[model samples]
Target: MALDHSLVGVASDPVERTWRAGDVIVYALGVGAGAADPTEELAFTTENTAGVELRVLPTFAVLAAQARTGRRLGDFDPARLVHAEQAFELHAPLPVDGRVQVVSTVTGIADKGSGALVSTENTATDAETGKLLVTSRSGVFIRGEGGFGRSGPASDDWRLPERAPDEQVRYRTRPEQALLYRLSGDRNPLHSDPAFAARGGFDRPILHGLCTYGFTGRALLHALCSSDSGGSDPDRFDAMSGRFTKPVLPGQELVVSIWGDGDGAALFRTATDDGTVVIDRGRVRFH
Candidate 1:
């Protein structure tokens, strides 16, 4: 079946979100924010003598609203929906306590005969200050949803250079990684309960999808951004995108390899400690 050209560039409903201090902390914990130490720098749950407001975790960009008002995934076969790729760009630092709004729009639609690629963009802005915070670009491949002849302009695939990686960064997860990441309000039991994981063909709880995204961002920041600059400057980094392959367990360490191909574009991969590639074929565009 061909994609339905009528559905190309179709925009979805806008999603609005407001975050509080507690919400910020929980999101951090879900990603193993304080797992390294009870007194880690990113820990927000600890009793504080300074009584400062909680700092927002950069990964919170994933939870921003999308236009789902008139759309329901169940309308299409559930198995047809697959996350293809995701990328995010940050413009300003986000605060823990603030009102935010997300406006998502369809950016691309490609028909791949048996499957369809639907690309969406989520733009987040601070409601109070009216500051543009972040923009998240995502694509989902729906296996059975194509054949309506829907496809827009041809998009370019990110190119990876043929060379060895210059730097590799790794992060280890605790057995309760999913438990911690779920505090961000993505309580999919597949990452927590053993029975649920078994039902999903997993040996144990898995990490949140966004946790992996966070790890990728952390790796990119380490590889591209000036670590000495504390990751606040977006000019140092260009862009990043990747697909999630195998689910990562909480206790696993993700080794990410990044290489500079000049012109600020780089390539990266996240693998397991045993050298199994978890996120294969990643590309980063740097400034």
Candidate 2:
């Protein structure tokens, strides 16, 4: 199961994806949006009645408009696939209604003695106008797919901040959060069907990693800045990168721990109630 370095830079089949109004709203709620005030910008369920033109939530790019033709992990093996890291870049906010096309490619494949890392990049564009909406980069570790003839470098070990965090925020997820989040477009059954999860090594349906990302954003909003306009801009969180260490079940309490790294840098980590660290070796940079 080791990484096939030959697969590096292999561009997968382009997939076309589209989004509807309802899909946008459901995605917003899945990530704990509108939980604090019910009047927040992400309260898509009610904000539709607001005066402004509604735009699809940016994170929805991960799910919506994806070209379904890419090579999936099933082409390899499910039990060996481990989501190692992920990141996103927003070129522009997507219009609520539109068809989009995404081009996904396997950018890098590295083999270590113990495991392999596969990196993929996805670029989404408006199908009609060809406007670039977002680009995503993801890396996954295939646990048993290593020890090939080649001796690639191992995954780097991260060093967390030594100082105690200056702030911590806790957020609660809805019972059906995964179901709601999946509506955004990621229909990975692992997050929906208990049978699939148990087979994948979980007890029950698990939350989407991006859902965890959204919840972390909410916690960051609380820990780093005020919800008021004078405090910070909602769009400030333009980029986020993190490593996924564990699965997050629905209704779990995520306690986001943050430490100021001085000179504009900050560190973060998210853990569940049972002391499970869902996100680790995390860092956030702001404008």
Candidate 3:
């Protein structure tokens, strides 16, 4: 079905979401935390132990993103929808367990002739205090659902730094990474069942894009925000925006290359250990 331009600017009903300490640990595990070395990411995957202060991964905000924005956009086929791009801003550190109000809005829609780019923006706030926690921006591509009328918005000028990375981090993705990540709200067959993935043109189940995005966030935090004394300081994170350049298979070792712009902006690229860029044109900014 074609996209109904009128659906743009519509807002979804405000919803309340609460997470427990266990929930945060599960989310951390799903995104590849502590799987290889528990000591490295223990603050996220393990808690209640001596000297451990549980913390939530900044990218977890996307988990509370618009769950039903596509349906509200129009009668577009769910099978053809693809998460095209994602951007996020963190205002404050998320409590290990607390209640938050989530409200989603259909911010904009762009017709690209062959498909429509639907944008949904989600804001999660402290349920009681009404303080904003995170703002997540998402864009989905609806195949064969464009050509109604409107032209797309102007493109962003986001570009990588000209120099090589100042530092790099390498992490190996577990073969069951997709299986673990699927438990964190996204049950897409493309990231789970192999038979279902074959139908979608993949050798086996692929990793969820958000899972990869979370990993990048982890890398950035470790590289740019870790305290000189040892632990991570969440205040260094401000925003992240990037493009999904290719499909990342389960078990692929990923290398994150980071370049700092001296102004708290980080330009980065995630690639296979073999050097195949998977998430390109990435940018991370910090407060």
Candidate 4:
């Protein structure tokens, strides 16, 4: 099937969602927020466990905008869509809980000989105040589908530093990690049912890409935005982008290398302890 190139540049109707502090905590836990140390990360996993309002992880913007992904893209079979890359630019820190309005657009689509890449951008604003909160961009790789007759738009291409990583953060994923992550609105059986995973040509369930995205962000927050560790502030985190290179099996150890850009932000690359690069060409830009 070919994508409808005509749909490019079209914006979808806004989707309004009401999220609460409890919802934020669930998403935080789904991504392993407090696993490093519950007390140290209580601000993320609890509303006021530390007497401060919880801070939403930047990656949750993807989840908040997911409902609108179906609007702009034309009738491509859901079976063929595969997530390729994702990015989020935060204009302001996400409130602990509030009404959010999400409007998405099909920024572009690229035709490949065998398949097509569909790119989308979703912008979210605070519903009550009309303040822009986040703008998220993502690309989907459709297999066995192409011939859309368009080359899409130019994507952002930035350079990482040429030196060694400045720091590394390590974390271990639980065997039931995927199970917990799926509760965060991604209920695909491929992530929960072993029989379904085997049928799909995997030995067991795989971790959600967004789950890994959150984990990567959590690692960054710890290494660069925490007190007494990297001597960084959470408010400094402004944006993050990454390309998924490999699937992560639950129960594997993830080690992420943090390279500072000499700016407030940094570049990141994550891999399993076995040296398999799971997230590549990753970057986080903060002010």
Return the TM-score for each candidate structure. Answer: 0.76, 0.81, 0.93, 0.89
Best-fitting candidate, measured by TM-score? 3
Tens-place lDDT per residue, model 1, 6-55, is: 54356655466777777766766666555555554343444243643345
Using TM-score as the yardstick, the better of models 2 and 4 is 4
Model 2 residue 263 distance off true place after TM-score fit, in angstroms: 6.3
lDDT of 1 at 89: 67
Model 2 CA deviation exceeding 4 Å by range: 1-6, 41-43, 51-58, 70-74, 112-115, 128-131, 149-158, 221-232, 261-265
Candidate 4 lDDT tens digits, 1-287: 24667777878788897778888889989888778777766777887564555778777877776663454355655545556789998888777777888888888778865778888898888888999988899988876677656676565676666888899988888889998888777887768888877765568878888888889988887777765533335677888999888889998888899998776778899999999989888988766
Candidate 2 backbone overlaps, count: 5
Colliding pairs, model 3: none
With a 3 Å backbone cut-off (N, CA, C), the pairs that clash in candidate 2 are 1-145, 2-145, 15-67, 16-67, 17-65
Q: For residues 164-186, what per-residue lDDT tens digits would candidate 2 score against the true structure? A: 78888888888888888886667
Q: Is candidate 2 or candidate 3 better by TM-score?
A: 3
Q: How do the residues 93-172 of candidate 3 rate in per-residue lDDT, one tens digit apiece?
A: 77888788888887888888888888878988888999998899988887788777777678788677777889998888
Please, what is the whole-model Cα lDDT of each candidate in the order they appear? 0.66, 0.71, 0.81, 0.79
Could you tell me the lDDT of residue 41 within candidate 2?
A: 55
**Cα deviation in Å at residue 173, candidate 1?**
2.0
Give residue 99's lDDT in candidate 2 (0 to 100): 79
Which consecutive 10 residues in model 2 have the weakest lDDT in total?
225-234
Off by over 4 Å in 3: 66-71
Better of 3 and 4 by TM-score: 3
* Prediction 1 global C-alpha lDDT: 0.66
